[model samples]
Target chain A: MTHKRVLSLTLNGKNRQDLVPDNMLLVEYLREVTGNTGTKQGCDGGECGACTVLIDGEPHLSCITLAATVEGRKIETIESLAVNGRMSALQRAFHEKLGTQCGYCTPGMIMASEALLRTEKKPSKDTIRTALGGNICRCTGYVKIIEAVETAAEEVAS
Target chain B: MTEVLPEFRVVRPATAQEAAAAHRDNEGARYLAGGTDLIPNVRRGIGDPDLLIDLGGIADLKKIEVGANGARIGAGVTLAHLAKNAQIAAAYPAVITAAKSIAGPGHRAAGTVGGNVCLDTRCVFYNQSQWWRESNNFCLKYKGDTCHVAPKSTYCHAAYSGDLAPVLLVMGAQVEVTGPEGSRTIALPDLYGEDGQNYLALKRGEFVTAVLLPKDVLPTVYEKMRVRGAIDFPLAGVAVALRRDGDKIGDLKVAVTGTNSRPFIVEGIEELVGGPLSDEVLDKIGDLVQKQVSPMRTTLVAPFGRRRIAAALARRQASALFAG
Candidate 1:
């Protein structure tokens, strides 16, 4: 028997209540139910981090996470990073530093960076690399991505 | 290639015994931890379970208790916690090293100690999309008859690639398991079997509750050869725990993973107990690892290469620990 439950969580800083199936993945819940398509589904399931999101301020793969599992947690996606219709520091860095090429991995990368910068105000390049290790970007060879994260970290510190 | 997840009801049990009871009550039910591994395999049409016993709700399965008897790590404790916990890091640096090396940061955040400990074996012939498996007629580990890695052999050759087991094995870890029959604690190595297909020795409704570490601490190191620095499972991982008494080796325990059906301690190391650390001793260690590890064409890397890498890693870690 497939079970359906009303999932109440904070998404993009807004409290939401959605009727979702028990087996529905968080990626599916965000994209299909809540109309938040920012989290991309990459590498079939968990092999890729294109579906990265912040659940209670920690980076997690939404594709492998069940929607019901995060019933009352705060979930931040790519959609949550922007405020007042302006790009966040990380987004601005990525845009200015040419961190994205194909742009498929941008949302997940930015979200993972957002989680890292929340706890680590000024992370070293190696720290940034390790924190964002799960969020892979085939384009830009990660040189620009690391630079973008560094730039954002510098901006935040300044 | 995106595959839709098959429909299944979720059972959120608050305790390990209750979780096991749920599995007993519901036919075709499987225990779900972090779901980092099971979800992907389920998407690939691995199992057709009707229900998932979500153990995440069980508070008992998420605690970390450090006492005189060492640490009792809850099975549901996330890898991220294990990686960052100062007490665990101070007492068992190898544990932190191995935990940090698993998959990617996001996966570590969601992956649990129990989940990684109970990770399913992997093979090139298996772990593919349904259509890909169909084209190859699948392998013995999953749907088909023949073991592609060794066609003449009846047993599967799927390799166990989890990083934590080897390090924990050397630390003399034990696991607390609960089932329909009740709870019992067993040594970590006994939890695994020789056969890759049926690697875990767990009973039908059994699940691990917590991992028990001993109070004794030995200087240990873990290293692995992988295609990438991060997000890649170890091709051949090795862990070494050594106690140096003056110039002689006081005690030593060597364990290996990613080269066999189960992570195991490399036996016959007792002969080196009183011997000084030397080039000959390191060479013998390498030889023992090479002789014991049975790597097959389960991965993209060559069998011989994996075996050599396992031996090399074992020797390297052993030597490094001996030096320190």
Candidate 2:
């Protein structure tokens, strides 16, 4: 009884089209249909934003966002952070600062931090803290994550 | 909760009237706004809608218009958008504050202001997996007779957890509801119902289109108590808007949430309006609120403690408005 619709979207700067079920979540579309598994799903619930993605340059919980709703919008996932096969500044910062102990939360943390830096050139620790509040990192304490964001900001600015 | 939604037809409507028409036509149809709350509820098997009326394409419902009088926030405006709006921040700081106080940044990016205003009244017993709820026959909220919170009571005790509801109520906001019949504007207070089983007082095939705030400027403060600094529902929340007359309060409004089935404005605020609102006066109001609202055991952080927190929130917000 469900409906199947063609979803045309800008994924990681590339225009793509696919037939998706009306009930498919944005996260499921990214992982199952498109085969982009960098976006993890820790808690399918809105909490523990493991599935955070950029919809129109803003961080959103893909687990709750409907794939059909974002048909024509731009979606930037964790995989999009790398440029020409080189790690993005935020990803490199996370690597150097030891931002991930288990690496499960790294994708979401990077995407969230990327969204923050994309908008604000120099975000304070409190601002960074607020920006990353949605995504959870149980493996590494946030000290390294905060430092990585700070470092990435300097690199992006320079 | 189930991850996959049950089979349902998707209707992409471009206008509010067409969306309302879809609602009117389909037997079991639901308006899909932000879908942050509705999707999860559907996953939990709450409402089995045969047709999903997708309202995302309606351009008219995605605007935030700031006029000379006040602001008109569309039902489809996301909390993140409203929170970051410079005009809304300057004019309706309380609304911004309420928007920011919701779940988290990512959730806020997807959750709508109207969704929060029409947020489901929550209860521990009712909001669980079927197996979890079925462990004991489901509660009074759905498919069960006994009120889990108060076994002898006849009604559900789910608390209204929306942070925006109280803030909008205190600001004297009006809501525009669209339906198959027509569109009508009503005070924010009239939009709600007292019963937890059916929280929103909407006519069949009706949905909220926009929220209209009052024009008059007033100093407003919103205070919330929660277990965590963020991503947690308020145990007790208070919104206070003060109309000042040269240091003395000319008019005052208080709305309390997370303490009852429906968020409501405190009555008899006029008694405290005509004079300078002192700490003593604030404390008296707090005590009265504490006495009046006894939080039930739905979301369980000791009822008396939540009551006390509600009172304290009101006192603190009132004092802040007075100081400002």
Candidate 3:
């Protein structure tokens, strides 16, 4: 469709600009243009959360979202979680807790956990479960993932 | 991962009138809302539109105003916002109930109420990849002559599985539509058509601008039957709004979806208008609704199962509303 324009947005705290097609998905734009391959595309149909990203600090499915629709907005991906080769508390907790089996859903799980922790200083197990309900893990049964998030919450609080 | 979208041009208009004007200029133009449904339909080669009018950026279409009369929700209001609005939650919890029931938190963040109200009906035989559909010979909903779900049927039988429309209709909501012609408001139920092939009765280049929900002090509930709790379309769903007069029913509206070609306002609600919802009475009403619903083989659930669940779900929701 006709609205091919110069799409500009803040990506991971950096100003980025690109000419994108009207039908380009946000996930594809992030991976291809921005080179953030950490966001996996498990199901391009939006059934899976592997393509989840924080649009203005809100969890959104990038696979189904059009890049042109989110123009001039702040986007945070899994790549933004770590800084200067040092893992964030949640990432370290995931590593310490071994919250992955096939390692596909880790990025989405961590992103969701990051959002939850930012809003709720200390989220209960049920609150954590409800918040991460959108991000599915096919390999691990989410037991360790939940524990990892809980541990990260404690670590960040302390 | 591109789903192989058809080549189309996008137009982002700042106002509803501008959006409508864009549609007036371009032929075969479609309004792009959240793209949760339209984008996928495009990937499957459903309706080919050369120009798309993007309504996501229009600021005027995203307002949520609650006044003495009722609430006026901009069509562009995201489903996630609706689920989180505290005042709206207290007054119209069923709207949130229906909103949260759809897909997951991520999809809900991207999905919009207008998109759900105008969502395309779905059928297992129709919603597939282009190649997958090609092998099976396309159904009437897309590019074929006959509907595979009901081969002998004259009209398409795609199931209307959206959760919001039935709830909106039950709440006596009115919709404001801006189109190539002009802006006009109509009842929510009037927006639908009987045939799935031409489900929405929207005029060409017309898009829903906002939903006007009248003040409803009555108790309401929405119950949906989906395969998974997190992310799946409804197999069958029921929405009920009730006003009780002491021990008798004062006024009630029961609507159902995910059962037939279009989400329909249950007929024979007059029976429940004045009677008490006793066990025997509710049991009979449930059975009668199932019979009147006449579930078809267009959705994931079997016809018999959907037929049985439709009324039971409605009764359960009704009872819950009363109990609460």
Clashing pairs for model 1 are none
Every prediction: chain A TM-score: 0.96, 0.97, 0.96
lDDT of 3 by residue, B103-216 (tens): 877878888889988888888888788878888888877778888987898888888888998888888899999998899999988999888889988888899999999985
Pick by DockQ: 1 or 2, better one: 1
CA RMSD per model (angstroms): 1.1, 1.5, 1.8
lDDT of 1 by residue, B144-192 (tens): 9999899999999899999999999999999999999999999999999
Ranking by lDDT: 1, 2, 3
Question: In terms of lDDT, which candidate is stronger, 2 or 3?
Answer: 2
Interface RMSD of 1: 1.2
Point to the candidate with the largest lDDT: 1
lDDT of 3 at B137: 83
Compared with the true structure, what per-residue lDDT tens digits does model 2 show for residues B80-190? 999989988988888888999898888788888778888888888877776777788988998889998899988888888899988899888999999999999999899
The candidate scoring highest on TM-score is 1
Rank by TM-score (best first): 1, 2, 3
Q: Is the docking of candidate 1 incorrect, acceptable, medium or high quality?
A: high
Interface DockQ of candidate 1: 0.80
Model 1 off-target regions past 4 Å? none
* Residue A127, model 3: Cα distance from true site in angstroms: 2.8
Clashing pairs in model 2? none
lDDT for model 2, on a 0 to 1 scale?
A: 0.87
